[model samples]
Target: MPGYGAPQNNGYGNYGNTGQGNGYGASQPYGYPSPAQPAITVGDGLSWAWSRITDNPVVLLVGFGLWTVLTGIGVEASYTVNGVEHSYGLGIPGGNIISLAAILIGPIALAHVGILTSSGRKASFRDVFTFPNFLQAFLAILLSRLAILIGTIFLIIPGIILGYLFSFVAYAAVERNLGVTAAMRYSMRLLSDNVGLLLPFALIGFLLYVAGAITVIGWIITGPLVALMTTYAYVRVQGRDVARYPSQG
Candidate 1:
């Protein structure tokens, strides 16, 4: 595996294979890159993610569908409150607690598939269930939201900024197996230099989701696309290379 002073290898250059396993296993250097690391634009990340989806359309659909069903079961189970028809589940300030299962598990599912896709391997249904560092991931999600909530208390803008800053916590925790604080800190530093690009990337992804939600069937595509785009960005920003295009079998 490549490290700090390692020479570039195909774009994964300085950073090597995340680890040896089905998922992005263990610590594979989520540290700072050389000062001159190339900046991956939002377009680059989206395009790479799109190519990956296009290449594995059927499998992605199956995988994401499976994920939806698995997570949806938990979400739906808590919908009824005192026999009332609560379609949206237990509500909170932003979203509902029932929906939190999806929010928490979505990224981990994507990270598993994305890591395989980026590694030039075929994505599979099992990837959705193959959670790496799930406990750390769960803790990171809760802690990051708590921090964001605190920031939100201060003012809306600070909350949004913290949201953007800590956006990659799940990736760091699951992919690198970092602890809660370490994962939060890693995510902050990862994007500290890329805020200008992060805002627009996030906005476009949100718009895609909203548009997809309106169409209903569109979520089948846009949902994974946006998640994979984030995965691409996270890998690239770490000074690693992603399979920009799909590999031929």
Candidate 2:
């Protein structure tokens, strides 16, 4: 909503002389395949993310740190019940409302951060709350979470599969300005085509989460690292260039 500048045309349809790299390898013309361009791997995603974070740790750290503080405040607000401790509520608490607002809005902001950083542009803390299509982004996230929850209820594997499949919903919503259903559908389509290249990143992210949990403070790095990696994958899958930070072997 804020003056975040015109949206970059990074979608699959407008892949012209954008000058962004094709993916993890050397730059190639749009719609043409290069034999030398190696397939993107989980390590590539992580490495690329690490490079971006190291390049601009302050922006990423400040943005995520603000998110964490707001989330904590929301958590604290939700527990107050008529000024009594452990009191029950018939509906969701006000603090939960704040927390939910943060959760719904935070990822979109993080996505913008990753997108801008990948593009080698200056990303500011204001980028976090600058969603032009806030309603659409919110519904997109809510429905995707609901779908994932339902899938997990049926079976753990289905949930995981659906989770990865719809993981790009926020990117779609932010980048393409698509509505809830369209964003989810777009994510599904992209992942379906590139599941082989993308699934490992999801697995790697899970492992990172596990490792971060062990260290407790490790997620400050892992959290933004995963966001950066996912954005890189999204840009590459959409045919944008990301060779500036090449994936490591």
Candidate 3:
């Protein structure tokens, strides 16, 4: 079990301590290119993601299961009426709220699981409830979504650009403990520097998302795969090293 930038064993048995100090910080001043960062390929990202999944199947599956249930309950179906598109949640009246919450909480929980398992600690499904920088992450994600939506209203291209630019905002907030503006800035720098390498990976992730949508069970695999892949890309793009599994050896 190899953790990212954090120590392998930090002595905290429970999920109380949020994993931090991964070379991502406000002090570093983002939005600049790192000249020495190596190029990462789409194959490398997918391979790393698959390796992590195989190595930590139980934790990943458990987390993904929780995410799926919450996400499904809060799932929204959209339809067009008189050239206007509208959506509603499938669950109860406030199901949309639950769905929005799921989007924010699910991935961070999975990242916590990643931190635990990678640090050689056994992770519990309850780790999904542990959120670090909750307010910051929530605001960053909300604002980014709103901005992307506004861009989309103007034209689809700006939305896609904004999507790519702020793709790693959640990871930045969760892993780096960045504030709302800092997280967006960090993500923008990462994307701007690695667009050549990251574009293909994003395209593949989109395909996986579509594939996952076709079947309920498909999400069990693709959901975590995409999450892990994005996490891997985040680390690599930042010029940090990822732990290679035994099979990758």
Candidate 4:
């Protein structure tokens, strides 16, 4: 996501259509903090990411590990062509399946942090996996990701726009007890208000993610970074307030 940058500076605008970015999100906030904004270092991003991975390593790992495993499973099925069968369909690999599962698990993650952040960022996964709410957590992960996916495709540029726009949709779902649509819109709103910060956040996230994904150890290590960032984004953007998930119990 961060690999691209200000169409003009990074030459991504022409990259999208010519390469795509399309001056796409400029109509939104289109404003970043003044040049006075300090750079968000690679280490800071990694630290935040690392803290999350370490904080709730178990559920986070279970949630994302399932996703990673499912991710590796591939999303194809077989079909018939003329008389002989061809090779391909659409089933979402273990990676996507796990990610999809995260939507459902989102509220759980929120509950994990909601009380903790409210109590002053002391959340852990201990209470996040109480069983009854697990399904809700799974749904939140699946639907939210899918909704955002749909929104992103609304227009190619818009899709990229939503890709960045709804960056924090999962967190909103839990913090606000929001359904998929509401949370997605909220994320879009947050990005519309803060698109500039997103690119940099993404750039850092991407670097960490790529580095982690470069190897099995990297993938295992970095997978949680993505989750942590997404979770942190949700908490920070939603603010530290006790929001109820839709009664997952």
lDDT tens per residue, model 1, 1-249: 122122112222222344333233212233333244346787777878788888888888777865554444443333667888556433344334445667676766677667667756667776667767778778888888888999999888889888888888877766666677877887888788777767677888889889876886787888788888787777776666665434433
Q: Considering only N, C-alpha and C atoms within 3 Å, which residue pairs clash in candidate 2?
A: 20-241, 21-241, 78-95
Better of 2 and 3 by TM-score: 3
Q: Write the per-residue lDDT of candidate 4 for residues 1-249, one digit (tens) a residue.
A: 232222222211211121222221111112322233223344444565565545556655665555555455544557887899887534554546564444455445544443233222333355444322233334545665565577767756655654576566544544344554655666677767765655666666677678875675666766666656654444334322111111111
Cα lDDT listed for each candidate: 0.67, 0.68, 0.68, 0.47
Better of 1 and 4 by lDDT: 1
Measured with C-alpha atoms, the lDDT of residue 248 in candidate 4 is: 16
What is the per-residue lDDT of model 2 for residues 192-217, given as tens digits with 9 covering 90 to 100?
88988888888888888788668857
Q: Report the number of the highest-TM-score candidate.
A: 3
Candidate 4 displacement at residue 164 in angstroms: 1.6
Candidate 4 similarity to native, TM-score? 0.53
In TM-score terms, candidate 3 sits at: 0.75
RMSD of each: 7.9, 8.0, 8.3, 14.8
The TM-scores of all predictions, comma-separated, are 0.71, 0.74, 0.75, 0.53
- Name the weakest run of 10 consecutive residues (lDDT summed) in model 1: 4-13
Measured on C-alpha atoms, candidate 3 has an lDDT of: 0.68
